[model samples]
Structures are given as structure tokens and as C-alpha cells.
Target: MAKFFKYKTTADLEAENARLNLDLRFSDDLSPLSQPVTVGTRTVGNRWCIHPMEGCDGNLDGTPGELTFRRYQRFGGGGAKLIWGEACAVNDEGRANPRQIALNPRTRDEFAKLVEQTRQAHRDSLGDDSDLLFGLQLTHSGRYSVKPIIATHDPLLDPRTVVNKATGQKVTADYPIITDDELKRLVDDYVATAKLAVEVGFDFLDVKQCHRYLLNELLGARNRPGPYGGSFENRTRLAREIFTALKAVVPSNVLLATRMNGFDSIPYHKGDNDDGQPDPWTAPLANGWGMSESDPFTPDLAEPIRWVQEMRTLGVDLVNVALGNPYAQPHFGRPFEYPPPDGYESPEHPLTGVDRHFKCAEAVQRANPGLAIVGTGYSYLQEFFPQAGAANVRDGRITFVGVGRASLAQPDWVKQLQDNGKMDRKRVCRTFSYCTALMREKNHPLGQYPTGCPPFDKEAYGEIWKEVLELKVKK
Candidate 1:
């Protein structure tokens, strides 16, 4: 296996970037990150955004459990002005896993308390909570859902959604796809969830359209028939309709947003050597959101650019640009030094993945200069993430630098930078993928383990990690 992270100094990291001819830049001046930015009618305190990192620790009734409260409380006190919350299903059947949080009248009170606690923690640490902007991400995990409600048949991804992994019983071609009438009902689900998010005191509501979920899958459903597929206008019909319906119901102060996939690269599998390799497919691939028809590996931003421009017209105030399907090509979205137990080794250098994120986000930002764009793929950079983020903000490449896995490792990273002008190297995430491993572990009575930085936040997750290790040994 390749051990890529060996940089002992900032200069060493820069040298490696230069060697790769990557456009990734860094700056010692971190003042740019501290500068406030305007989103909708609110002015976010800073550019450091704590991405919605799910713990999968919710109670069986869909309430925030003790660990869930602890996780968000840390993010509230972490000092990032924008806290993009994790995925909460709009309905029970939409949940990706048994433990995934679902929002409804039954669970609304708990959500309100979660929001209140998060804001209170921020006020205690930073002296004020008015400048902080928090959002809730709502999603329906399409093919990845527990029972697999797919948009269309995908030759590449179908095999991975196994009914029984040991028996290799996969989803068959005869399996039914979600109908247009069902999609219309799902739109209502999103609208209802948006209203609850506003009532719960969230600053914004993210209609999650990334990571090959239901809406994202519809975006690439060229083969499917009817008004919700085929043409570009038809493909985006559900999202447009949902956004329009949300605008009519939600108050003007509550912002409409989406975390969208800028590109859906082809799926990969473990080769003979246990390294990730792309599955075989012919040119002119039918199922990909922002990918070139002729070359599925490379990004074709034409549709994604047009979609963002359309979102601006439909009153979308924020857009978080993400890449790849985490389940299929994990390296594309999250460049990791080591792969998860269920995953394979990196197919290419992690630096290459980082560069792709920068270039794609740059294209989207330049196209839609009006929308507040949050760029992903920064967690793999570790210690120098702030420097790169500052440079990007200074260059007008992106408005916010989003940190996902790294936030679990150091929730107070924003405060650390404000005081010391650098991160605590000892606490910086090394991209070990332990969090991903925990997310995959479903041996518990509650159906899944809560994911966190076991290496850094040992007090909370060390014992949990031991439990996972023991479970693996027995398996």
C-alpha cells in the first residue's frame, strides 16, 4: 500500500504540489478566512464551515441521542460561522440506514432542542450566536436506502446493492423503479420537512441532491420515461417543482439551498491487488449527472453550470459543490491515504483528486458569481487546509471552505487558527478512513455504530472502535 502523507513542513507540502503541477495554493495570511461573507439576508461570521458530518447515533424513534447532541454541541462551539448539518430523512422509508434521523411531527420537538443546544454552545464559546448560520440537510437515499428505491437501472451500481452479501443476491432488472406519481408525493415530503426546519430555527434548509441519492439519480435518468426523465427539462423537473413549492410555503428569511454533485464519475471495484479500478463500460454512458457522455471519467460541467444558473433563477441562495458517488468512487469525493475495510486502495494519487475538486468548484463559482458556493474536498489536506482555503477565497474561487471528516478530528480548528494562526498538528486528521469504517459497521442492536475520529477523539470513540474491532474478528 502507498503511504502518501509524509510532509513535515509547509514548504514540503508546497514542493509536492509543485511537483504534481497542481493549482492548489497556500498562504500564511489567514485573515481572508476570518472575513465575513453575506448569504441571503444574513452575514456569516467567517468562511470556515463545519460540514454536516453524520454520527448515525440517533435513537430508534428518530430523536437526537446523547452522542448526537455531543457531536453538534462541539460543532456549535467550534467557531465556524456556517455549520451545514448532516442528512436527516424527509420520511421514514427514505432513511439510508436504520439509525438515520427522520424528521416529522413526532420528532420535531427533539430537533428544536438539538438546534437550541447547538446555538447555546456557540454563544458560550464565541460570546455571540447571531452571526452563526446553521442549516439542515434533507435527503432520500435512493438506491442506497435500506430497501433500495432506485430511479433507474444502472448496470454498474446494481451489483453493489446486494440483498445478501454472502449469497450474492443482487437487485435484479425486474425490480421496480420509483414512479412519477411517487416522486410528486416525495416533493411534498421535502416541502413539509422544509417547514419544520424553519420552525426549528435553522437558518437554511438543504435539499440534498448529491451522493447519488434519489434526486441526484433522477438528474441522470436519461433512459427512464415520463415527465421526470429523458430531457434536461424533464430530468430537473422534480427539483424545480420542489424548490418552487418550498418558496411558496417557507418564509422569505429561510434560505433554500442544495448540496449537488458537480460530477458523477464511473464506479470502481477492487482489482486483483486490492486497488480500486474502474468497472468496464462503453463510451457514451447513459447514467451520470455532470459527466462527459464520451468519457465518463472526465467532468462535463455544461449541465451542472446550467443547473446552477437555473437554481439562481429559482431562488436558491446557496450551493455546495460536491463530486463523485461516495459508495462507488470514494476517492473522487474524499481523497484518503488509506481505504476503508469494505473499500480498495487509492486508484490515483490523493493530490490528483484534490486538484479535480478545485478545478471543478472554480468552474462552477465563476459561472454563478451570485450564489454562495461552498467547496468540498478539503479534509484530505490536513494541516494546510486553511492556507489553501484562504488562497481560494482570496482568488474568488469559492465563498466557503467546507471541512467534513477533519471537523470530527478537530472541531475547534477555526478557533485554533484565530488564536495561533495554525492548526494543532497533533490533532489534525491524517485521512485514515476510520470514520468510514465505523459508518459501515452495523453489528449493534441499534443497527449501526456512530462514526467519529477514534484516533483523535479517543475519549468518546476509542471504546467504540474496540467494539468494532472485536465484531470484525468474530465475523
Candidate 2:
């Protein structure tokens, strides 16, 4: 194992960690996130790819605008190598935020602008040798597919998660199940979006399979009887066929990967057991939908490894591993109440949380070193990421580490270590469970632009930051 060098966050190590470098400036080398890094057969530049977030910049109708123009330019210059265009809806209803960038037409100009600005800025920041790859997370919320419950299925086994509009009455679903043709259209949607991403300047694509989306639903044991349901092969058929075809269609230079969630904490799902069903694995659909799984998620490593193997055989470049998703249960480290309770994140919960994801990635690395494996999880504990990454790199355990939430608030997280030995540990975000909670809300609308953290959102975005900062008896 590489000698452990830890920090509070990348910001915690700041300039101090730079001295430990074995290879600086792989391209611009000075920049950590922008620097080229290796993954399986293909090389992934830098260590960071901005996690899809709400409204850093995008128009009201999901178009790129000055907000995104300036925002991406700011972060692009910050030296991030792989910049994913925001979580774009493959179809209209799939969008996470009404303002989220869209991959389809009518938003083409904005996307092109996004492509131009991000590329020009990155190129300018790192020079030609710096290879910053850009990608977008193609996602659909499924039951949680995003407001109005406009899912493919009827309200059979829906969670009935509501929207938080001023005129709030829970956003109940009348229709739920997706049709066979619709499923195929969903596949075509992914292909079209992939093409659009490539055209808009994104060099990579992550067909999102995480957070109980339409894709994972097919893969899950709970999927109702359909051509896509039943055996594991049937479940993964769409992902396999779609991504494989996309890999062929997109340019050879593009890096393609998928971010998926396998278990939901609720009953009939793999992660949770709230319903107390004796045969958790065989819970019948409340209406016609199937129940969640009882056993923990195993992610069928053999399946994805072979999948990655096939992709590499074709032209795909990466395989990111994951375990239970955030939207799913046990929810390991998230809050039961407000302020997130204490002792939750203190390494107590193992298989039930994001820790499981780490363990999953570590295993995937050892087994498939040739496949570029990227693993993602929470905001905290990133300071230990490099040391964790070293194990994967040196031992061929893993090739890359992804930080989702921490980087969201403090965009300059990595370089702070490379530049000044100073890491901003006093998180700009105060562990409020906004991220986890808001989505779980009853009518959480698709275009609902949540400003600031949750639970305490009313507090922080409401003025908690000002009050706390002022009251802190400064040393």
C-alpha cells in the first residue's frame, strides 16, 4: 500500500501535498483534476469529473446559457479533465431539473455553446498536451424519474414520492408502467443523446443507471414480466445493446461508461426490508408491480466485467462500480432526522452504505485491473481518497476515484492540495441532508431548482450561514 497521506478534504492538504508528487504535470501536470490519469485500456485525464448538479448553469427550458457559460468556464479553467455536461434528460420527462441541460434538439445552440466554452477554456488552461475529456450523465428518474410521476409504468408499485410546490398536495401517479415500444424508444433516446453529447463537444458518456432509474428498474429483480425482465441477461440487455451500439457510433476518442444503482432501501428492493416480508426476494407487486429484493446487492461482477471486457473489445474505455444507491435504503450514512444525527458516518455502517461502494470498487479493481474502473460516493472522507487511490493504482486495485458531493460546494478541492498545503476543511456545506431528503419529498418536481442544502435549507439558504459565521467566536 502507498504510504498513507490524508487530508480533511483535498483542500485540507492544500500546497503541502504537492511536495509528495511522483509525477507532476502529466500534461499541465500542475493541475490535479486536469492531469491525465490511466484507466484500463483507455486513459482518463485528471482525477475529477464534476458530478451532475442542479443549476450551476442551464436555462429555464434546459438550455445552456450565460450561467452555464460562465460556470463551466470557471470550473473548466480550474483544470478538471473530464467535465460531464449536466444530467440531461434523454427524453423530456427524464430531466432531473427543468433547468438541467437537455441533449435533444431545440437546445442545440446552448449545448454547442457549452461545448465551445468548455473545450476552449480547458484547452487554454492546460495547453494542447492536456487531454480533458468531457461527458454527460444520461439519466431518467423512473418512479423517481422526475416530477409528475411521468414514468413508463403505471402507479403499480410507485413510491408516491411527492413534489414540494407551493400548491402542494402529494403528486400521485395515475399511470406508471412503460410500454415495450417505449422501452425501445428509451434505448433510442439514449443513442440519440449520446450522439448529441458527442456533437456538443462532450468526449465521454455515462448512461446513468443509478438511483432507481428506468434502466436499473429493468435490471432489478422487481421488474414486472417483460422481454426486458426475468433473467439477469434480460435485465442488462438494453444497457449492453445500447452502449455497445453507442460505442460504435461515437468517435473512437470518446470514453463511455455507466453509473448504476442496484438496490433500493425499501422492501422488495435489494437494499431495504421495511415491509418485513418473509420472502423479501419474492415480494409480490403491491398492485401489479413487483416488490424489492431482500438479499443485499452483489452487482453481478462477472456480468459487468464481461461487459467491460466486451466494451474494451469494441471501443469502450471505462467501468465504474457501485453498490447500494443513495435513493435506496439502509441509506447507511444519511439522516433519519435533521442535522444528520451523530455517529452515522463514523465507519459504523459498512455494507449498508457508501462504504459498500468503496469495497465494491476495490474488489472490481483487483479482479479487472485492465478495465478502467471509477468508483463514486459521498462528500466527506475524500481527503483519504489519494491514499485510497494509491492502493488501486499501485496494486491494480482501481485506476480512478470519483468525489461527488465534496467537489460540488468547493470546486477547487484538488488543486488546493497541489497549490498551497491548505484544505478548506470547514466544509462550505454543513452536512444538512438536503441532497438526500429533497428527492425523497412527495412532489419533488423535475425542474424544481433547489437552492442550497436541505433540512436546514430553510436555515442555510435561509440565512444559517450568516448567523453561524457571525456567532463563531473567532480565534
Candidate 3:
């Protein structure tokens, strides 16, 4: 309903920033981005990182499909020093979709080849792969899983959880949550997966704690009475257990990392004019990891800061900070110009959301100066993202500039910056949200449609988008 991105130059963007009184800064000197930084025992080649951008195109058997291979290969050659691999389920039932990749004995070989080819492609493109750091993100989809394995019940989110995708039935109050014993058993699955990841040549393993996945949901499980819920110590028990378990088995050189939610804002629903509006709720919210219990709309970062401190003690080398539950408030994590078909239009200016990401990440980074913190919510800045990223790195606000939707649009963004000193204007991501729309389309024979930037990577996703349109019309 509102047009936001209308800047024609850096000056215009700066004017808007001034008008909004935002802390966003930019630098013409991108040298900071090219500087190498030490992450754990390894030195990453640059500050650019490719966030785990899943295509949802893996085989039903949990092996990398053709499109999956192609996506990683492109990222390998695209020149980012750190390649954060997409989510791979710890087990079959934990999968977000039928096609989500899962690492196991049967698919171990395929994963190994994936890592090998990705490194080979990087070597072929940059003449070296020594500085490239590759890692895998392990997760259980929890509430968003195919069968909805929720951690706790929330008045706001339970009704939104899909119990049956076919009939669009949502979860009820009586729906069972994952038991504590099941959570302890799930830890074993993570340990086994971490062993497999090391064998497959991944440099790090991210026990994913973001996006309201199983582990992340556990972080906000304040109601469930067990070892894995209620108090802060109990809330973080699973992640700490997983990381401690991983450290004992894997070699010291293998880094243990987590992409965690800095703030889990309350869910927003479609309001007047189809714009996003916060769902009605009372004070002292029951389930929000890094949010204020008394005022759900505001962020209270005390717990998140403490969690990062504890992670350092457990040997976590990297911390990628994220915000919001994508299923409930997509705009909070990714500030997009448009919304997905199932999503509501952003309630506030996109710049406001971007500023939220920068401020939240800065707080965490400053709190844990020893850890390498990767900042999110940059893709919405379009061509100016590099300038903002450079300023953040120079100012010591963040260690890495990670992009997700933007990476899908232009995987070669790092190379572009290196060779041309700027991103190709035509290839820049505008935050159109087409990728999110494709991600929400689950009518495909394969259980879900593969998501990519149809506007930019037309060669791969153009036909896929066409099929989505056709399917939508039939519905």
C-alpha cells in the first residue's frame, strides 16, 4: 500500500535516513569488507557471508537434488569467503517439508560430494579455497514442521500452526507438544549429524536456533514444565547440551556456531487494507525468546546477551544474529518491498525494520566482543548494503555482512564488489519477496516448489515461477 524504496543515489538514501533519525551509516571505503578476519582457528577470506539460503529442492530421500547442487555451486563460485549451508533436518519427522535435506548414513556420500564440489568450484573461480569457510546448519522445524512438532502452546501461534496441510487444519489447544524425553533423544540425533558433518568435510556445524525451529522454540518454552523449558537455564539447556556434545566428539578445529534469534516479536495478522497488524495479546507474554514479557512489542536483550556469553564458554566461535519468527512476522527478519501471497503487507516503513536489525545486532556484538557476529537484514538496502556493511565492520559493530534473499538474487555479489567496486545495478535485489512467495507454494508434486529469484535468476526460476502462477490460477 505504501512505496518505500525510491532513492536514486546515496545522497537521497542519506536524506531519508536523516529524516527517519536512524543510526544507519555508510562508507565509500569498502576496504574493510575485503579484509580477512579470523573465525575460530581459520581466517575467512572476507567479511561477506552467504546466509544459509535453502531452495527446498532436495530429494525425498534427503539427498541434494540437481537444483540443490546448482545453488551451492553458484555460491561456491560467487566469491563469498564464508558459505553457510542451508538447513538439513536432524531426522525425517523433524523436516519442515518432505524435500528438506537431512544428513544421515545413506546420504553421507552425497553431502560429502556437495562439500567437495563447492570447494572445487571456489578453487576454480578464485584460484584458491584455503580461505573459504563452509558450514552446515542443522535444525528441526518444530511448529513449522510437516507434522508440527511444537515445543509449547501459545495462544497466538497455536492457531496458526498447520496440523494438516491438505485441509489447512490448524493446531488446537489440546494438540500435544514434543515431550522432554523426545528432546533428549533429539540431542543424540544432532550429535550423530555433527559427526557426519565433520566426516563430510564441513568446517563448522550450526546447531540452528533461529526462525522458531525446534531448538529456537525451546528457547522460549517458558510454560512447559521440564528440564528443557521454564527458566533461562532450562530454556537454553538443549542448545548448550548439543554444543557441549559436539565439542567432545568433533575435532577442536571444527567450529561450533549458531544462527540465533535476537528477538522473537509477537505474531502479526492481516488487518485493515491487508496490512500487517500485531495479533491481540496480554502483557507478560508466555513465549518469546528475546522479547519483553511485559510489552511484547519491544525487545529485551538481557537474555540474548547472556546466552551469547554462555555460548563463548561452550566454544562457540561464530554467532549469526537474526530476529522474528518468519512464519508469524516475515517482515521482522527480512525487510521486503512486497509480501508473500500468504503474508500481509509490512505494517511500518521497511527502513524501520532494517534499523531494528542493525541496532539489535550491534547490542549483541558489543556485548560479546570475542565472538564473530554476522549481521542480518541488509538485502533490503539494495545497492547501498555494501556501504552500510562496510561502515558496520569499520565501526566494530559486526564481523560479517550476511545476506540471504540478496544472495539468491546475486550469488556473485562478492566478486562484483571486488572487480567492479560496486554491485551491478540491474542484478541488485529489490526485496520483491517473489522468493518467499515461491517458498509458500506447496502444491507441487515434490511437496514444495524450489525458491530462487525469478526476477534475476530467470534461467533457473523463471519457468518455476510460471508454474506457480498457473497453479495459483487453478486454485
Best by lDDT: 3
User: In candidate 2, how many Å is residue 232 off?
Assistant: 1.5
Sorting all predicted structures by TM-score, with the top scorer first, yields 3, 1, 2
Candidate 1, which ten residues in sequence have the lowest lDDT sum? 159-168
Clashing pairs in 3: none
lDDT of 1 by residue, 1-475 (tens): 9999887776888899999988888887888998998899888999988887779999888888899999999999999999999999998888888888888899999999999999999999999998999999999998988778999888788877775655878888998899989999998899999889899999998989899999999998888899998899999999999999998998988888999999998899999998999999987677889987778888999999999999888889999999999899999999999998889999888988998999899999999886799998898888989988999999999999999999999999998987887789899999999999999998889988999999999999999999999998988
Model 1: CA > 4 A from native: 164-168
How do the residues 1-475 of candidate 2 rate in per-residue lDDT, one tens digit apiece? 1122233444444333255431211111222333467643346566655655554245667787564566567567655565655567787777655556676888876788877787787667666424666667787766554464333332323443445446554445454456666777777788888888888777678877655566766666334566776666666667777777787788867777776542233322321322212123333442111123332333335544554555566555665555443433423323122222111222222212344556556666666656666665544343444444444345444455565545545555555655655345554343444444333322223334333342222432345334333434341
TM-score of each: 0.98, 0.72, 0.99
Candidate 1 residue pairs in backbone clash: none
lDDT of each: 0.91, 0.52, 0.92
Give the poorly placed runs of model 3, Cα more than 4 Å off. none
Candidate 2 has what TM-score?
Answer: 0.72
The better-scoring model by TM-score among 1 and 2 is 1
Total colliding residue pairs, candidate 2: 47
- Measured with C-alpha atoms, the lDDT of residue 385 in candidate 3 is 95
